[model samples]
Target chain A: MSIYLDNGATSYPKPESVYVSIAEYMRNNGASPGRGNYSRAMEADRLVYMTRKALCKLLCVPRPGQIIFTCNATESINMALKGYLKPGDRVLTTSYEHNAVARPLKMLETDREIKIGLIPSTPDGVSDMEWYQQELSKGVRLVVVAHGSNVIGCVTPLDEIVSAAHRHNTPVLVDAAQTAGVYPVDVTSVPVDMLAFTGHKGLLGPTGTGGLYIREGLELSTLKEGGTGGMSLSPFQPSDPPDRYEAGTMNIFGIAGLNAAVQFLLDTGVEVIREHEIELAQFLMDGLDTVPGVTYYGPSSAKDRLGLVSFNLEGQDPNKVAIKLDRDYEIMVRAGIHCAPQAHHLLGTAPGGALRVSLGYFNQREDIERLIDALREITYS
Target chain B: MFLQSINVLDVDLCVQQPDKFVAHTRASADLREIMPYLNSMFRTSTYNHDAGSIKFTNDKIEYTIIGDKINIAKFINRTELHELLDWLKDLVNDTYDSRSEIIPMYVCRKPVPVLFIYNLLPKTNCQQCGEKSCMVFAAQLNKLEIDIEACPILSEPEYTANRRRLEGAFGAFS
Candidate 1:
């Protein structure tokens, strides 16, 4: 069996319930929510509402109605960035950010003339609090930071970041693509202004499912406007959210899958998953330490980062090594910049990226050992 | 059959149609206890269990019941108004008697599309509802701001078919 170690890109082999939920929704209740007064349509509306409530329980969100569904975390980040930022508004972001945050901010720089400031940090994804605090005093409109770095597998200290930004009366937007399902993200405890998450990743849902949680009273301009199945006569969009931000018929099929997936997370518990990941990550780190010619990036301890690693051989190119592993040993991993050039630049591995073996709930110790065995041969052969 | 009598509380000018009137009535029995039963009975209802209110449309009239206070909107005159109230009193008494047979659903049915209501309008832009156009009247109707009977044009003999359609879609025609 080919090892699937690319949970960072998109999770595969989703929970059976996720697949079943999507198929059931498509086959049985094929109706648009808020579009009609039919019983089936109302059922669809209940499914959506239940999913929102489930997410609120998971994220510790205060308001369920503010959670707006988007195609993916990228769309969510775009909604938060484009909708929240005014022309010429200043934003402070981190050095190791995914293209989701980088690309949109780049476009905003040119189009809206917004000044984008980068906060320096180490490869372990800990922000430079001294510099961050100094900049906060200078006054910025927004702070965008990744809750976890995809390239380095390091988790950022969100508690500190959110509190510092809030002290300055500035709102913080977090990209939780890498950490959401595997970590205990309590929005009530942290009180993040806005958070974007992908349903397909740690959430164990299908692709094309993700959402944004906007704190109560935090209004963002709508990115797109169309029929929300209610209030069709009014030319102006609804001032209240979920409706305000969400327009057009949603992917109820995918949302059905997400609802089941989140329910699974709630049932299994994220703390259980986190403990399992640490065991796998520490095992991989331990095995990698034994092999010669392997230089991995990120924190020394597994507890300090996500269940993934980015490593390079002494003389082998990351792409060739990944191809050899797949062709010869039936192993799969990600190579190249992984769509985060800023992260690669910070690690001094700018152009040629490292091999990324991101672990999933399905991954076991045997999978990591197999990966390690494959790397040992690839190093010598 | 708990609600034996429904006393008229007050009467006022319908906001959407000043020619028409909206009336408020106080039910003898607490109607809040049977809201969920009414919610399950009416498919096109917007029920707020927390607010203890259920708003629904029957025939061409709209009714919003909060606790024991009933706000009935859009009737041609006082004669038809009492007839509507009496119809409601009997309907509630019957529903309460049959509560054990029905499954009470707390989930509110989402709002009906204004466009659907607009399609049922006469499209005459006839300022008969005290509104500039029929579309605005349809929007107000969707929000429960005005009653369906506000558009007197729909009551005309020529528009009987449209009125029947409205009654069929919302509730049973009297």
Candidate 2:
């Protein structure tokens, strides 16, 4: 049996209802959303709208129309970065952000004239809030921070960071790639201006589904131009919230699965899901800590981590360890830069990166025991 | 010298007359048998033994297969060519995989050839070239065989270090 430990990349064996709803949508109502008001097309539109509404409720944002569906977090980030930043403005981000955040910023640096400053994080994945504040003081227009570190799995203190950035009169865009569905991300309490999330990871949705939550009053230009469902009489896309950003036809089947995913999370509750995953992470960390020649990086305890652990063993390349785990024990883990070369650089895991074992709600206690046992075997061998 | 060199050229694959597989659904077991047909129809001219080696390694099995212009030529003649094309279509339909997306071939120009033209211009990424990245401009230059006179950064002493670095990175694509 293969034990999957790479949920940070994408979740596998998504909730049963999610799969069923996607199939049903494709079979029964697979039409271009908002393109026509026919029964099937309207059904598609409603399904996608429900997903936006669910995201609004889940994140405690003010309006459902503010949630714009995107192909993934990368696309969402691109839309936000390109749509928001103009030439000569400054953007503040953390050193611990994933490549989804870093790559877009780098591309923007080349295309648009902007000053981007990195708020450095400690080796344990904790960004110094004071350092973030200092960078925000430099007339920053937008602050893009990750809700959780994809490589190390530490959930940053977003409430404090958002409040600090707000003091500087800058809008904060949180990349909740790992935290959105697993934890209670109350936009009301956190006071964030925008939150970008991937639906396939913790949300248990199909791939090609993600959204950007833009709080009211944050006006961003649209990246793509095309026909929106409403206001056909107007030649240009409406300057409203989502239709302004979402130009092409929405992914109806994907939105159906996303809606089902949100329902599953709401039923079980985000807090319960977070507790289950954190317990698994703690279990794995404790076992790995006890073993000889194993070195785990991140928050020493699981209290600060979401559900991910990055580690390396003595005299063993993380790539080699990952291969051994797969070939011998059928245990899957990701090894290498994890697409966040800067994050790995900050944690001293650059060039050749560390072994990342990220957990999900589906991971059982026995899975944790199996991983520990396999590590013991490799260490002894 | 070319034999000693390893080039990681970007490859774009396509099945000529793909309308045949519009309705085809099954896949052929011998995937290699279908490569030649594609090469012949796609205007592939050169064939190299060491050039088109496709290796999949997992620290076990170490499966090694080679597919060059010649193999793609043979692929065009297989009895199961339709089935092979059908498998590719099915793969695309079932999963949103970019691996199945065909990207055009791009060979990074060698530094020696590039410098002959680059020597005339300032080798800067100052957006004076109207390109976002200098490396991207270099790739475009290779495609057009055009000289690099538009760059503003190359004239500056501060960008002297970057010019050499870009040359080394683009040198591998050759």
Candidate 3:
């Protein structure tokens, strides 16, 4: 089998429970969650509710109702960004955000005349707290930053950023696309106003699964309005939590898969997965250090970043390396700007981009060894 | 010898029109020094400094140069193949003569991948290109399966730069 290393894009070989739950749900109870009151419908509702509960536990969100399911983090972010920002509102974000955050803000900047302040980060991809504080003092309506960069895999200082934003009575929205499952995101402790997460990546769920966690008192207008099973009589959208946000029929199968994946994470513990993934990444980075003509991007050490590394071979296009790796060695890695052009520009790998090797808990040391050997051959052969 | 002989070593065709072909040539000197020159000469060229190779396209013909060996693809006939080789020979000599004036670019000039291209796309996932996502459309573009004109979003003035870059990297719109 090919060695899968594009976990940052979307995790593969999802845990056995994820597949089982998805299949079982499809085979037995394939009813919409809130459409009916039959046994099958009730089962669907229980599944979605349990999925929400699982997410609340994983993300440290206070209430399960606050977890609003979306197609992916992109939709989650769009809901938060488009729903919250009005014309002329000031929004602050970091340089390391994916297009999920960047594109929405870019659109709003033009459509609504919302001012965007980009907080500069260190060379290692950590947000500059002083710059963030300065921006916060200017009284921005909201601050949205990625918890971890998809390109470099570096985790931002979300705690400090959130605390600083709170000091100025500004809300902070965290794009936790990269860190949600791999790292501990204690919303209760961090006081983050909003967080958007995807299930297909670190959470080990199927595709088309992700959600947004809105803080208790904060209200975001609905991005889409349609049939909510309960609010059929009213033409206006509901002013509640989950149903208000989820307009159409939910992706029950995806949520079932996510429920199982979250349970697996809860059972195994996130710290254990984090430690394993970090060890594998460290091994890959250490091996890369010996390869000639190889330049890695992001923080100097693996400890400071997520379980991934981005690098480029001298004179080789990242696509060429990735293609060779797949064709010659049956190894899989992602190569490109990683849907984060701003981040790549910050890492100085624009135009040609860079190759990314993202690690998952299932990745063993042997996988890293094989990757290192392949990279060595590609670089030095 | 300023230029020597070109030979078609092997041709492998999976379908009616061969998607890929391999060839080699004997030259007086190593082609490594002239790679960057070729890269600059071709809009669709990617030069790998570490591997000492350059891949570029002339019209519809894609060429990969390593030392004196050349692998080419997507030729309709022998005449087209010979014409491409002759053009390459001239490019090599011209670049060699003008080496003093030319600055060698060691960076890979490859087209940005589908994801990067997709980022620049409208990303409405509107499926106007007959594909589900803009990412899929970008992938087809990379494979030369489709052209930028197929994307309705490119017609918009807002995406003029993206259209230009795509045209530059892939070649003039088909």
Candidate 4:
């Protein structure tokens, strides 16, 4: 079996429950939900509804329907960005946004004539809230910030940022692609307009399933108008929480798997999972620091970041190191741009970025040692 | 209603009003079935399917056909673009490949032609992956975004000097 380390991309060896539950759903209650009145269809609807409720409990959203599903966090982000912004509306975002968020905003910058102001993050990937407050003073309509940077894994001050945005009457859109399941996102207490997330990343769901939590009554122009099963009779799309934004048949299998995944998190308890992953990250961080010629990024302490690390070896091409780790060592790691060029640029890993070793709960101390041992050999040789 | 204009095999489909275009679902097979009718709408000559891209110069739109599975067509005028999107959606339902969804064709302005940059050195640079000229290999590599593993020569220590310099020239993380 491949030593899978790309948890930042998608978690592997997903809970057996995830696979079994999806199969169970497809085998027993496979049908277009909300379109039919049959028992199987109702069962499918119940499964989807339970999934939403599970996500709500995980994110602390009071209402379940406010959670809208999409193919991935990128699509959810695109929906939030495109739906909310009107021409000339000023959106304040941080420099640390993923290409998923940055690319859509850039497209809008070029074509839609929307004004984008960036709140530059510090070297450790924390946004300069003073800069954000300054932008808010300049009439910022929406403030989009990542709960954590995917490249460096630095967790931002979400509570403070959300509180600040609320003062300006600007609703913040938190891109929780990295932090959703690993970190506690209590939407009930934290003031945010929307929390865009992916099920595949920390949530441990299959790929091609993700979603957004739009605060009730927040309006967005529907990115795609389609048949949302329930309101098939209407000419215009239904103006409801999920159906308003979620247009089309959902990724049923992926969602069923995701429901199981989220259920796994609840059963295990996120606090325990978070504590374990953080400890593992700390273990790896401490191990990586002892190696000579190794330059790491993100907060020096593991307390400030997520379960991922980005570092580079002296006089080593990240790609070469990645190849060596994969082929010779059987250790899998990501090399090159982690899709957040601006963050790397800020961290001075620009142009040629660092090798990223993102750890998950399933990762053990022995795995960390193997990585450490491999780095020693790769760096020395 | 989620179907939109899809440019397929050199065809502009479902031309309609700006706001009415629908998003195409991956399930739709009808979009893939009308390729013959869609291909007939082409105004260009160089129908090089192997090049992996279809060019529509008059309208400044390029539809890069990613393999036989996915077709991403560009629309220049944002107005009535939905109509074209709708047509494309119909074709996608008809012609889509079974195994893959093919990367969605994103509408972009800059012609980021994947040009390969190689070390312009005359030295044999003969580090083994077999090609006599590193420049030719770079050109071929640039033309096709293949994995660096395919280029056998880069594995050698002799080409080490050129590989470092060459990867820097072609910036998106060599």
Identify the candidate with maximal TM-score.
Answer: 1
Off by over 4 Å in 4: B1-174
Off by over 4 Å in 3: B1-174
Model 2's alpha-carbon lDDT is 0.71
Please tell me the TM-score of chain B in candidate 4 relative to the true structure's chain B.
Answer: 0.30
Per-residue alpha-carbon lDDT of model 2 for A47-142, expressed as tens digits? 666677778788897766778889999889888988999988899888888888888888888888788898877888777777777777868999
Alpha-carbon lDDT, every model: 0.87, 0.71, 0.82, 0.72
TM-score of each: 0.72, 0.68, 0.68, 0.68
lDDT of 4 by residue, A1-381 (tens): 457677887777688999998899878778875555455665566577778889988998876777898999999999999988878889888887899989998899877888988888777887777778888888877888899988888888888888888888989998999988888888888868899999988898999999999997788888999986543445988665677777788888999999999999998888887888788888988898888988888887777888898899988888899999999989899998989898888888888898998877688888889889989987777
Per-residue lDDT of model 1, residues A1-381, tens digit only: 988999988887788999899999999999987666565775676688778889989999865676889999999999999999999999999988999999999999999999999998887777789999999999999999999899999887888999999999999999999998998898899989999999999999989999999998889988999886554556877667787888899999999999999999999999999999999999999999877888899998999989989999888899999999899988899999999999999998879988998999889899999999988988777
Model 4 TM-score? 0.68
Query: Candidate 3, overall lDDT?
Result: 0.82
| lDDT tens readout by residue for model 1, B80-104 | 4555765798999998999999889
**Interface DockQ per candidate:** 0.03, 0.01, 0.00, 0.01
Candidate order (lDDT): 1, 3, 4, 2
lDDT tens digits by residue: candidate 3, B1-174:
455545444334314343333334445567897887676666567788788888876666778888877876665322234456656778788788887787666677555578767777888999988998888888877766567799988989999998887777665312
In candidate 3, list every pair of residues with a backbone clash: A315-B49
Question: In angstroms, how far off is B62's CA in candidate 2?
Answer: 70
